[model samples]
Target: MQIRVSIFLKEKIQNPNGHFVLQTSGPVPYGFEVPGLIRYFNAKGQEVRRTRFPSGGNYTSALRQGSFDLSGDRVTILGTNMYNTPSSQEMDPSTTSNSTRKQKQADTTPNPLATEELNLLAKLMGGMEVQKILNVDAGFKVNLLALEQEEEGM
Candidate 1:
């Protein structure tokens, strides 16, 4: 029987091992296997690491101890049978023609200034510092009428 499993990154706990707890919950079939494997993937769809659930009598038992030391800003998790095949499997370069490789190569070039990095830099520098660094001219002009009125009032 096929069972649906959902894995969520609950929170990162400070411990000696820098443990991160992942909560898994879903419908379980009778006599389902316990201590399944959980695979982690990066944004590039590459398998970075895999961890086994805690050994216990049932799937839920193992899932309760789903703590890992993995650290990443973004991650994708997959359980067994969740998909027909794992998404991280590398493509056979021989199967692809040269044109496909060329297109991929063109897209693979990393941008030096990503929007997120720029935003972070701006935040670090603050608005006034950024304006100064950019040489933004906050042009100040004196109003003749206002000056004349101020002198007359004085």
Candidate 2:
């Protein structure tokens, strides 16, 4: 499944206006190169983004927090962070960073999971906790172009 959010500029736009066109760092589509996983068009009526995620490919992506802003004739998709495969974590920069010596020092606030009870308590902290108290989808937020579409009555 693919979702798109686009903003139409009052004036014609150049490709430079496009944000996050494609990436190898975030979630990539099944059997597709990251460079082509997403396509961006800055033309007026062509919509801004086209992301592909073919179904039945055992492909699933985790969504990160996002927001949107809609104006008279424009929409802005704040950003998106979709998940790649679980086994592919080694290829993710963010994941790699977490293991960095520097990151480990900052979060050195030892995961309070040392004690069995705190370990259980950690399950309750969710997003605020580096490790979840529970995987309650606490930090997940999806922002779509619903407002812009609503104006179109669809």
Candidate 3:
């Protein structure tokens, strides 16, 4: 079964191990299981990574403790919602309770990368030439634009 979920990174905490702790938020469809598996995709819809929340627990809190090595900033997470109605009493109440509480807490935390920063990072990582153009002080904007036009012409 296909389940549509809107996943957004709530906060990113830098860990001592150089990996990041990503706190994400999204609505799990009614009857969806908690601590479910989430597969992250890039903008191209390519599956980049996958993670599972600890069993028998709320994912919002568990996600805070999970570590990930994400190279890009934008991601789309996909997961299946097994049921249309809640059958497990434990899953219903805890999911709602934890989501509500975490929502508030996540809002107060700052996002690791702003939109513009993310865009720049994506561009810099596009290719070695893009990185070189961004680093050079001489007409970098014009050079980047020209490179884009060249790519489109190909």
Per-residue lDDT, model 2, residue 77, is 17
Q: Report model 2's TM-score to 2 decimal places.
A: 0.15
For residues 1-154, write the lDDT of model 1, one tens digit per residue. 3332332122222223444444455324334454577889999999999998665433342223322323211112332223333234223322445565465457656565564465556556543222223555332222334355786786
In candidate 2, what are the lDDT values of residues 9-118, reduced to their tens digit? 22122133543343224344334443436577776767687887643234334334222322111111122222222235433434544245354346447444355455
lDDT, candidate 1, residue 89? 29
- Give all TM-scores, in the order shown: 0.20, 0.15, 0.20
lDDT of each: 0.42, 0.38, 0.43
Off by over 4 Å in 2: 1-31, 34-105, 118-154
List candidate 3 stretches off by more than 4 Å: 1-12, 22-33, 36-56, 60-141, 145-152
| Top-down lDDT ranking | 3, 1, 2
Relative to the unseen true structure, what is the C-alpha lDDT of residue 39 in candidate 2, on a scale of 0 to 100?
Answer: 72
Model 1 local distance difference test score: 0.42
> What CA root-mean-square deviation does each model show from the true structure?
20.1, 19.4, 17.7
